[model samples]
Target chain A: MSNFNLKVPTMASMMANGETPEILFWVGCAGSYDERAQRVTQAFAKILNHVGIKYAVLGTDESCTGDPAKRAGNEFLFQMQAMQAIETLNGYKVTKIVTACPHCFNTIKNEYPQLGGNYQVIHHTQLIADLVADGKLKTKDNKVFKGKRITYHDPCYLGRGNNVYEAPRFALEALDADLVELKRCKQNGLCCGAGGAQMFKEPEKGTKDINIERMEDVKESNASIVAVGCPFCMTMLSDGVKNIDNLSHTAVLDIAELTALSNNL
Target chain B: MAIIAQILFLLAFISAVTLFYKNFKKILRNIQLGKSISRNDNKKLRWLMVLKVAFGQSKLAAKPIAALMHFFIYAGFIIINIEVLEIIIDGLLGTHRIFLFLGGFYNFLIGSFEFLALLVLFAVFVFLARRLVLKLKRFSGAEMTAWPKKDATIILLTEVVLMFAFLIMNASDHQLQKLGQAHYPIAGWFPVSQYLQVVLPTSAQALVFLERFCWWLHIMGIFAFLNYLPYSKHLHIILAFPTTWYARLNNLATLDNMATVTNEVKAMLDTSLVPPTASENATFGANDVHALHQIQLLNAYTCTECGRCTEVCPANITGKLLSPRKIMMDTRDRLVEVGQNIDRNGNDYVDGKSLLGNYISYEEIWACTSCNACVQACPINIDPLSIIIDLRRYAVMEQSQAPNSLNNMFANIENNGAPWKYAAADRLNWANNLSN
Candidate 1:
């Protein structure tokens, strides 16, 4: 969309060139496949490219982190999948990973060590916040989001699961938008009904879906834009917005997308 | 007459301690029924958690009003119990005001105890109103329909009665001291109970009887409350320390990998790796209390039935049948039932009932979003989500039962290396659209 061309390299391609990228961009299953989430992946890559930071993706070598399988009570399948992923990651000697999906970030950072795959993994929001502070990324000319009311939906894996409640907020704060908070935020944030493998299945018979209830918090915030850190939350919240008539105007964008837009990348 | 009172006091003290010991031994045995887990690591951190969360009541600060009221009651419980030491000594030695020799320090101690007794009384009234009159949503969950509701009410009421007995005892004792009655020394301050002296009889003989009656009632009520801890959610008063000490220190996102499953997967992945030796009777996951870790079982026993877990659960808030509080309650109930069953039958007998189907249903287990809000909301670090996951593990692995959607998703993961049916080759497709 801008004047610059974007470059995304693969780990294998980089290693063949006698180069090791600073961080591996783990484009999770959703970021790679889900139509809505692919845009987020593209947007984040554009930001990294504009900032002139060297990053690589696992490409076809990447696999599911088995978060859903583990949470769905398929431990054997989870370990099998985790072992495969760990093998690929360890083969690359990947010591630091950055992912837009909190699920992937959590599994690689916390759960993977137990299975003999360990790395310094961080959610993309943390990377963005750090980049902003380092003067590598600029948001001062953010005409796109100037004065827009933006609320953040905390992904459980990133927030309560990892105790990372500030990095995402810091990213949002750097923008020119008026940062608003949801009624249930941080430690008390509500789920978007897409975790624990519920994202794949119909919720077991409840009066209302969890996403719809969470959307109520978003609606009450009265923010035109709801920023999310996890791709799963993006899909669920986007679908949830379609169900509410008054919230049709509300846009759910990933924090990376917002940052890319603001930076004019 | 004095010797007779001393003998009666000795009998009461011995029987109360013995009964409490017997009941506590059963509780310890029931906790041992769960599989042993090694939480003995991280000794320094564990004690720090006990000091902060349990003793400091740090987590309760999430709700300021409840935290303040609970602090009053908690401080009263700990501080006022020191006065019990004096009562015990006086009862045993057949002495009156036995610690009066400490003089000013004794007055300071009694003065603070009286002040704390009044605060406890006020706090108990507010707690009772919160439960009975206010009808708070967290207190009225489906799991709290009967015994839980009564248990909370009974604990608060008992505190109120106990505090009243304490104040009345001090009040009548003060009046007897004013009259210079025999065995009633002019010792100890009565900062709060002095106000109640207006309600006491001025006659020394009547005042002594009133003081004696209240003193016996207060001590006996405490002993009764001590023994009742095993049967009530009020057991949190004792178990909270151990529970916080043994709580899972890992991030909630990191579900523990099944080591047995890891060995099996490793063997399959690496040809040179030795095939894992399978135990003849190893189960995949927990179906009964015995399969769960002893810490989880302790978590069940330590749950205060506050419904903080349920209150913040996404599934429960959305009207799903999955209440995290109920999961803990059901585990405890089933564990107690299993203990009774073991009592009736020998250790080898099986009742064919389990926590999975008998108490917790498949519907409740599957409804969880696993957001960890429930885990975050728990004031004492009780992890209800772990129990839910264990139940899910039993449902999916042992019985090969799961919701149809999850079953399909699992197959997709097995075949496609993702939750969906996308080819792994297509993972780089998103990058193709970018200009190079």
Candidate 2:
């Protein structure tokens, strides 16, 4: 924390100072708990700080958004969890929210409206794209990813569910990498088999696992790096790449991480 | 003789109508078993949806050839029913060509009816060829086995025979009129039936009997077809309008929130609010037909069983056990079975079998990606995902029978306030040692 000089403020602390944040940074369960996804949460925070953006996390007040519970058919548990989060959010009168995870982004944007927690919910990539276009965050010259093949895997919740296909691409364009597309991309992209609360359960016995099949599409693209927008997609696709024969050569990075690295943050 | 004819007609009509009404009542009772929901909002949009989807048959345009063929049969069946009014009056009053008093207008109406009948007959043969001869992949599958296949064949054959009888009745009537027989009015032109006049027996007495036999058979066939609808997928003819009106008008991907759970959570958030006592309910999601919503019950009754939902399903394409068509069929079958059980034993009777395990396997429900492909593909807007999610709710909340990976995830969320095993204090570690 000393080396980074990151002045991360919680919503409670911000309220104590009588300062209201322009946006609430919702670091979802995956972003807060998963080690790989934690990197994404940090990368996004660094970008916000560098851009002089006003944002705060719920910190200790944060709880799971109950997306997995709802998707898994545990509506009782989901509501119990969602209501607590909504109460905390409404207490702060949060108007704008941005998250690095598509699962959280989707639930807050689409589902929370019905639960009376309506906010201007946005995925981090969409915010990043807006920031980049506004020239707030400058992209420094980086030789590492320049001309390197990177394929963007569309998260089911973000792409098909929400119809967000271009924001991540715009963020990736700032990296100056040769961005390719998997054949099954955009509206028709195959699930990484992580949506619908599948991340919490073992996949049923089948001839081929969904992730393994999706990895085959990635391998055919021959891109060394696969850019993802969702943490669940990152975990599943990372496992998928490892299961492939050429394990060491490929890397899976979140769009925020890619943005952070390219900007020398 | 006239009084005797009227008595026989009344008896046949009453019996057929009573049977139809009894079957309809059973269906209504079965649907009432579900929890009440209000799809009553958005009256204007609902009306528009019914007009476009149900009355317009707009979704059929996805397959142009099939749509054209289906339109012929659908229009023919509806238009031909207008003549039934004349048949009923003729049966009771012992008269022939009763509507012929309208002169040239009557001639045009009969002419159009005859044309549609021929088109309907031609379309039926085309449909038969598509199913039996062409062996379209969507028409034949695991769900298409036995009864479903036979059901399609039976409906097409019945329609063909009914149309043929109508033409035969007209041809013999025309022959009788040429001989200037009593009560056989000189009415209208029958282009196809006029050609059929040459094939009949020349004896006037024999012609009278043939004409009467064809007349009775045509009317009786119509009554029989009406009753057969409740047992076949052809129930779509009547149920389609209501089903379309109640379809989800929002984004196809949006899953509905369980209101009963949302209010409880709201109470938990504010301690001053009294959270409703958690009822020690037997199940969380749907365990039986009674667990579903009223609109869902309507959806089960409205399935055309054309297998369009199954055809577009990614799970089915990838060889998974999940078939949206099978899901709808199983719901209807279970509902019918439950209804019969109630009819036999009291309404409180329970069936040993249920939709979740007995009909739809857990493996099948878990296999769904919840892609909304099936819902989008359905012509009448039947949502299989809603049922799938409800059953999954039962599996996870009531039985706690979720896959092992899911249990671990739930525990992680409970302990760490996230879906991982790490503690909250360690959440900021990734931000450390950054160049910023």
True contacts kept of each: 0.85, 0.43
Query: For each candidate, what TM-score against the reference?
Result: 0.98, 0.84
* lDDT tens digits, residue span B263-374, model 2: 5666766768774665545445797799998889989988989988888665676677889999999999999999889889988887688998999998988888776667
Each model's DockQ score: 0.77, 0.36
Model 1: residue A94 alpha-carbon error in angstroms: 1.4
lDDT tens readout by residue for model 1, A89-138: 88888989999999989888898899999899989999999998898888
User: What pairs collide in candidate 2?
Assistant: A73-B393, A200-B405, A200-B406, A201-B406
**In terms of TM-score, how similar is model 1 to the real structure?**
0.98
Could you tell me the lDDT of residue B215 within candidate 2? 88
Off by over 4 Å in 2: A1-17, A31-61, A124-190, A212-229, A233-265, B1-4, B171-211, B259-273, B276-283, B433-436
**Per-model i-RMS in Å?**
1.5, 3.1
Model 1 lDDT at residue B201: 77
